[model samples]
Target chain A: MRLSEEQYELIEAYLNNELSAADRTSFENELQADSELMAEVTLQRDLRLGFRAIGISQALDKARAQYNANRRVEAVPADPSSKPMPVTRPLSTWQYWAAAASVVVVLGVGYFVFQQTTEQPTDLAYNETFVPVDELTKEFPRGLAPNTRQQFLDILKEYEAGNYSTAIDQLKTLPADRQTVHYRNFFLGLSYLANKQPTEAIPLLQKALATPSVALRQKAEWFLALAYVKNGQKEKALPTLKRISADKAHPFNLLAQRVLQKIN
Target chain B: MAIRPLPTFLSDQELYDALKRRDDRAYQYLYAESFPSFRHWMLTHNGSEMDAEDAFQKGMLSFLLNVETGKYQFQASTQVTTVLFEYCKRVWLTELKSARVRTKAAMPDSVDSMDTGNVVEDLERLEVVNTVQKSLSQLKDECRKLIEWFYIEELSLREIAERLGMKETSVKSKRYDCAEKLKGFYAQNAKKMGL
Candidate 1:
């Protein structure tokens, strides 16, 4: 009772609501007549749910990481001297000399390693850090007019399909009203970056960081830092990257740290 | 170091909508905002911090699954945080009941009044998710990516074709093949898990 390709496609279309009214009615009638078909539909639905759960589970992991990081930051003593100090005998002179010697050895090794390694290209760092946004996961902000929403969705389709040049063109033509400016800027910046025009991406991404949505702002910050690196403005990227890397609760903290290591 | 502020929702409905949309900020906000009080509650209820964390993860997963699958609906009377806390509390209670740790503390009368829906059934459903996840992992790299992009990412055939540098027709055929492979794996895993 294995389904053929057409049957599979029809079932998928039915589930996705992509079938026409007549087709849907016919499919429903067929499903009612066939128990196996109904079971297949149920299985497909469950499988889709499972896939979605995986995505949700990943999001939960991110949330957990952020919570733990915040807790760690909160756990740090605000004033080091406020806590009772452990009573210990003073370090012997030989113990002090040994500690000093260890520091000198470590410094020597670090200096030698620094001298031997050439600075890696920013392209390497950019490539390592820059993951394009999954356009499908994003929803258009509320308050968009129907026509404007359709236009934006079409642009996202292009972007998702890797038609970045077309997406860029479509994005530019969208009206940058207060309601739509942030959405337009973010996607356009992403499009330009994906299309290898990081110079054009920088300003748009910078504007996108002004988005009222915390999630969108976090995304913009990460991409803007990458845009700086890709545009050979490493010095400009430093402050943002350093801020992100130092903040354990930031979603992109580890990635920012890796980028810093590669570039520096 | 200044901690980053959690995202604020205008209302419980807004938070619920954000959760349904799988917004990362909402998840983080929920976790951060709910945890301190939940941890304190756990500590006072004969549970350790580790127990609290485990219950929180399992409870959050179940609550979120219910939210996404329309098993739970938003009610203006009940705040999202309250619902989340109840779910975690039920998870802890279920664990305590199973481990015979309930005798250590006198159970509060309020615990029996809370309508935390069947935690055991919710966990059973999660096992199905685990089976699907394991089956997905067993797929070959190409098939796995194709299945993920198509199903999870919801990318279209044409979009996937472009990314893979294949013709749309070929991509369609490949998708069918990959999906069949996934079904085979899923069936085996489901049987193994007695689902």
Candidate 2:
């Protein structure tokens, strides 16, 4: 859409940290190519310099609050951070994994939504989980009496449709039981792992592994080990895999064997 | 090259300039002053605190993007506060609108006050920014240091991770997490300050 004068002016105003993302990015390109527009924008930027700019510093309050001093994932000194650098930095143990989950939540969706540095692992692994969260069932599947098999199918639909954020939120509200619980736990952990936030994923996978059901036990153990690996604890992971691989009949035993080879 | 302070471009006018110059003081001043109000506005309608923060970080990113791309301009004497407020509001509103969560609109009750001489408003906005900066000082040592390192130092993801002894990929994700934590500090303090 050809931007009108006010639209152009509004965009320029926004550029001085005045415009929001929903608006700025949509028109950022158009402003770049227009020179007269560019001059007008520069003038506005100059005048506003003395004025304290606007931004959603609050929205990111989560990031600012808790810290992983031990992990050092966020401890990089800012020197030319404009470029996304390669990182093989160890994903540390998660202490206070609050709600800013978008980073690793979507990793299993297969997009690499965020880039990585070379200091980190060269090969990225994709594993999804599902767990029974009460709140998730309300938004996901309205009824639970439809039989365990069908409930699992419906829950799978939610994961496949990419409603993980919703799934995670809802799962938080649900009790840890019910037949579909395992599935929900599995995928929820997977979503976190996918987003590359294994610290968050580890607990959920640990919970999934805790379930007494043999069906879930092996799978949960497999992911929990992977979660440990992602968090840079190959030592802890080695045992988890070794225990699972001992169960020759377990479905995930084969997967566990492959992982044990890499870490061991 | 008399090392004349590079004339500020229209786009590179806000925190990005100080950020590019690795000026932690200016970044702290700007971040502490503005984050709470943005957080308050973002939390409208039972939205998670993270939603507001995500929008906030995204807004800052867009601001930097515009400045870096050389598309930012200043003409009207609009304070940076108004611009950023408008930006964060628009971004949050778009999210709300897209989610189709109907509620009280985010439009301001009055902006006609802006018609007054721009210079006066600039002073008022600067005052607001200063209030935020003071609030930032209230943050604990780790939080404060982290913020200073990030926006001010402009460190790369890998560099920050390595220095901090964190995984690089984890650091990128954690920056957002830390930002959300900082917002919590701003909100709690704003409540006490009654701002």
Candidate 3:
């Protein structure tokens, strides 16, 4: 039965216990008399329950995200290490060109020497298994607003089409709300890695790891580890990779174990 | 990054009030304070980290539903986390019991301590909620947004109307239409799944 506005309001008030004592008694009488009204009340009650479930679930998800964000900040520091560096002082005009020439010659010979040497463990391991995950469809939020969802899908299309830079540009334009923040950070991090911007990918991937979805966290962890390896931050990558390797049931566990063995 | 300080303890009423308001910080506080111990307990009880996560999610949904529906009364001296842990622990124990049953093995001693009341019914209710969630995901974008804004988010009709650039009457009508569509989808899925 199509409920009128007054009927809907009355039902809502009754459910919320906003009905006056006399009105509540009358409503209860009507409920007993009319089975249809009782059925409507039941439906309304169930719907409210379902909605509340969704709301709380969403809140829990956001809380998870907050937890993840906290973990990321704690785990990743601005200066991961404090290695001393040689300070460059100002030089004369002739000294600048001469220094540049010498640096170029040294780099040329260094490159040749490095090429002839045995591959570094991280380099070999990363090269053997590191491939950017390009599947963006699954990362799309199922409950985003229509316009935002379409825009995000379009951005995903860009990422899938190998337009990493274009995708990143579009991703930067999207505001990071509660619904989109996790995906935004994760895919954007991957996009940065795809574009060979590992430094840029680090923080985003770290933040993405803080998401409450276990699947998303696994994906972020795997990619984040690879990002560290690509950036030559072996010290930071090893712990994450070890965690993945230890989880025998994780999707990335076998690959992580292989990477661990090769790198070690 | 500034770290949010979590309380070492909170009364049941305080925790329930925070949860009812959907405070993320309160949730973070809850997790920080209790989950580690809960996870440790799970790990010691033949449960993996993944099992702990899954169990926690199930238990949390049940707990939050009860909190929202006023089914969980705040006791004067109860530790909220203790109650939550019991609910979650029971869920894991129940799962283990069922698995053992499936294998025709003897019941484990862990299941012996559980005083079963309405846990099975609660689990079944959560399963229905899960089914509803799936149906909601399958809803058309417009209908989903309409239903979500009006019901889930609890936005006023006038507010939604202004946001959508529609008259309040039209928004109300659309909300009803969307609700009906949602109900149709939910009903079909529930029937198919025997929810």
Candidate 4:
């Protein structure tokens, strides 16, 4: 008997152990002389058995979260002694971002060590004080800590102080894996523009725009948007700036919003 | 307090409930449970263990932020793992784009011989997915919920029809017709996406 769709379904149910006694007997009779029906039954049964073999959700209780066993003190560093981070970057590229990345790496390594060396206070109740002063946090944007993120900020200081040449040179000595590579590129683009070289600045700024990290991507694009304006290529920069301002959630949206107004 | 054990095959609503209840433990359980397969997927894509770890972290952060910021409105029908994996993978791509750290890591060749059944099989699966989504969009308040309960949550079709005061036969037919519509939709969209 050539199996009809119903007969095929009946046989499938039987082979799947889904049929009752009456249905199974009917399916067996239905399969008589229909070797094709028998073949399908075998194929489906084998495939289902294969699915069960791979197994699913068998290790729920046993698997451990990665951060659990690796214990280190989780406390803010006390007077980190203003040390810089070290970054181990294999140098091959001559891109300005690559140069900036090296400086950022040193600062990151310094932060990592400082974070590691911090003493964990036993008493959480000992202090809950909140005091703010411009002098207290007046460190960064002033001095570039040898192995810290401040090094990039330090370059910014040089740029802000009308010493673009020194800032450009200072960036090269940075470690290879610094977080500030984002800003380094941003500022490099800006500094190059400041020194009357928008063409050299364009690629560096473009790197910032294409940054993968959302915060950095937004920041880079925000500045690239500005850099476009500064280059007198207002047509080119306006669209880019519009993108940053359009992202209402970004921290720089307000800044981008203001800048867009001036350009338009 | 009697703590509800986090369900293994948790329905999306259950996950949303757990999430809404601010149960960190449940989220941790879900992450630990799914990590191995997800890690394997990363490896298959030529991602190092470090890459997997970083990707998972970013995914979790995005998930939590979306939840806390009320961006991820509860979709009662969607699987938590599906949402998590999708979000995680997007973050991974974003990370790869942004990190700019070049690695020689290469992805394995694409699976060439996925056991595609009858030409109708691919179309069938595609249709089911599409019909489900489309009907989901067109359905009224209750019909949508009923279908989700039937398929996604694996509820008995008889129970779904009965609960909604509909004929069981009609429910089955509607479901079939919906699936067929989806299959046709798949046939149409597949061409568009160049699948």
Task: Output the number of the lDDT-best candidate.
Answer: 1
By lDDT, the candidates rank as 1, 3, 2, 4
In model 1 chain B, where is the ten-residue run with the lowest total lDDT?
A: B98-107
Error of 2 at A236 (Å): 1.7
> Candidate 4 at residue B97, lDDT?
37
Give one digit per residue, the lDDT tens place, for model 3 in A1-264: 677767877898998899999999999999999999898788677667777886776565444434433433343334544221111111111110000000101000000000111232111111111121223555666688999988887876565434555778799999999888998999889777654456677899999988888777877887788677655477898998788778887766655665565345
Query: Going through the candidates in order, what is the number of backbone clashes in each?
Result: 0, 91, 1, 22
Per residue, candidate 1 scores C-alpha lDDT tens digits across A106-128 of 00000000011123211110111
Candidate 2 CAPRI classification by DockQ:
incorrect
Record all residue pairs in model 1 with backbone atoms less than 3 Å apart, i.e. clashing: none
Interface RMSD of 2: 18.4
TM-score of chain A of each: 0.49, 0.42, 0.49, 0.39
Which candidate do you rate higher for TM-score, 1 or 4?
Answer: 1
After superposition, which runs of candidate 1 have C-alpha atoms over 4 Å from their true positions?
A73-264, B1-3, B98-117
lDDT of 3 by residue, B91-170 (tens): 78877776677778988675856665667777777656655655665566577767777777789999999989999999
Which stretches of model 4 miss by more than 4 angstroms?
A: A1-264, B1-144
Per-residue lDDT of A1-264 in model 2, one digit per residue for the tens? Answer: 333545544754576467778677756676688786665455334323312232222212212221111113233433333322122244332221111122211111111111134455322212122222322333332355656535445544554333443445555555656655665676678665543346667878787775666655655666677777755577888886787678787655544665564344
TM-score of each: 0.55, 0.30, 0.61, 0.28
Candidate 4 C-alpha lDDT tens digits along B1-195: 111233443466776667544454555456645565666777777564445554554455445435533668877678777777866665555434334334445422332232223222323332233222332334443444554455444477798788768899777666555433433443344455444
